[model samples]
Target: MSNKAAVLVAGSWGTALASVLADKDMEVALWTRNVVQQEEINTKHRNERFLPGVDLSPRLAATTDLEAAVRGAKAVVMVTPSSAAREVARALKPFWHEDMLVVHATKGFEIESMKRISTVIAEELGCDEGRIVVLSGPSHAEEVVNRCPTTVVVASQIAAQAELAQDLFMNPYFRVYTNRDMVGVELAGALKNIIALGAGMSDGLGYGDNAKAALLTRGLAEITRVGVEMGANPLTFAGLAGIGDLVVTATSRHSRNWRAGFMLGEGKPLETVLSQMGMVVEGIRTTKAAHAISEKYQVQMPIAAQLYHVLFEGLDPRTAVEALMGRDRKTEMEVMSLETWEQWHT
Candidate 1:
């Protein structure tokens, strides 16, 4: 296979992935919305705003014209922030062809539609499911650009598409796994960001490792519950997209979601924290959508509920924590148990 591909990216993650593709001898076109970013990549061979200090390969170039960026590309790897995924997808529609393979690296649910990035792509592009792929895992953009060993999963119902993406992007520092569980994979990736927000809040609250661990574990349980109810595979949550992503996102300083939660935990207003981060924190919005989804599905999502209150209700973070602590005790596995499942349906 020729090492030539195009990547649509607007942030550090995009730059990092572009750098990876270029390193693998792929002729990568890195698209950006900002003209200054395009100049930086073309002139300095560095992405000053995103992946600073890392030298990008000469094989990679940058552009802002959406049509020019995607023209004639066999594959399109979208790394725009989740909040902008739909808008970007809409903008790309007129340029998209049936043969183009689209891959998304964003990990968040659209708050307005409660749709995953892949779904947003499909709806916007009017494309078949086989043409879209999602790449996710325990990866930090900062680390990935630095050549840290990372593993990710690529999910698509069409094995050929997934395998094509895997072959195109995989390298020694980056390992790729494939799965057919698109819904489960997408849901696992999007929902984990919400849980990571809670985990970061726990740390900001000065909670111990046990608290963080408990939150992470139970957060996975609830995420799985919601996913299973929504027709996703239960086992996917136990795999990379689920547990793996949750752990990395909840703990990493490089995670914008975790950082946003940490700020909230420290008593900063959501608006203020957001202004300081100056980037889209998918978890904040995902918390809202996840809570709504849970309510719609009649699933218990205490973490998402607490997070929503902290973010939107103007409730004190400490008070939110107390409320969660005061909930009536029940078996942790009750939600996932078959007997309880039968009881719910009955």
Candidate 2:
């Protein structure tokens, strides 16, 4: 196979991953729909709109044609927003070949079907769901482009495929680990955005670190509870895709979700916050999906529920916090059974 990899959509994350592949001495194709952005990346080696001031790798090439990007590529990484994942996958279906490894870095659920990105891609490609790998962790595109030391996990039901992905992206600056808990990894990656939104809202409401810590703690609990119900390994929630992603996305200044939630907590309306952020805040859309999932699965997701209300129902952020704090008390380990706790400890 040729040492060529394609990254769909030359957004911040996509561009950064493409750079990683380029650093690995692979020919990288960075695809963008915007003609101007493609020209800028090709000529100047910069994506000023999404990642300003960062010079992309010289080995990374930009393209506007999807087929040209994917053709003869060993791997195709889908980094489009969750909202556009299906459309982009459909566009790729005609060019995709069985020999190519498919991976997605998207971290949100489909609001309409509540399907994960891998599932959407599989449906679009008419491929087995298990063949798709999910790459996730506490990764921020800005830090990654700067060659920051970042560790992430790639998971798939097919262990070989996961290992293939691990080998593709592994390098000195960026570490890649393999896991088989695709469901857990994907769920953790997607669901943590909800808590990040809540954490940002808490901080914007002038709550101290103590309050934010409590939110993070309880938020992990809610995430683990629902994730376990959804057939994910509970231990995955404690791993990189779960707590690792939760901490970074909730607190990092580079986090669009946190920034958007902060604006909302500062009393900005949803529409205004979204308009000003100039990026898709996955948490807002994920909150809607999580709310529906919680209800459908009969899981209690007070944090996500509160976030859904704040984002969609126009509930006051402070009032939502009040509601969260005032909820009926329960045991800290309510979601964990005795057997599960013993298994974890032993």
| Most accurate candidate by lDDT | 2
Worst 10 residues of 1 by lDDT: 335-344
Clashing pairs in 1: none
Once superposed on the true structure, which residue ranges of model 1 sit more than 4 Å away at CA?
A: 1-3, 337-346
Q: Taking the tens digit of each residue's C-alpha lDDT, what string does model 2 give over 95-176?
A: 9888899999999998999999999999999999998999999999999999999999999999999999999999999999
Residue-wise C-alpha lDDT for candidate 1, range 1-346, written one tens digit per residue: 3345678875888888887888788788888878998998999888866666888788889999888888878788998777888889999899888777889988888878887789889989998766799998888989998899999999998999899889878999989999988888989988999888888888898997998998898889898888878877788899999999999999989999989889988888988999999878888878888988988878889988988888989988889889888999888776464744664466
For each candidate in turn, the TM-score is 0.95, 0.97
Q: What lDDT is obtained when candidate 1 is compared to the true structure?
A: 0.85
Candidate 2 off by > 4 Å:
336-346
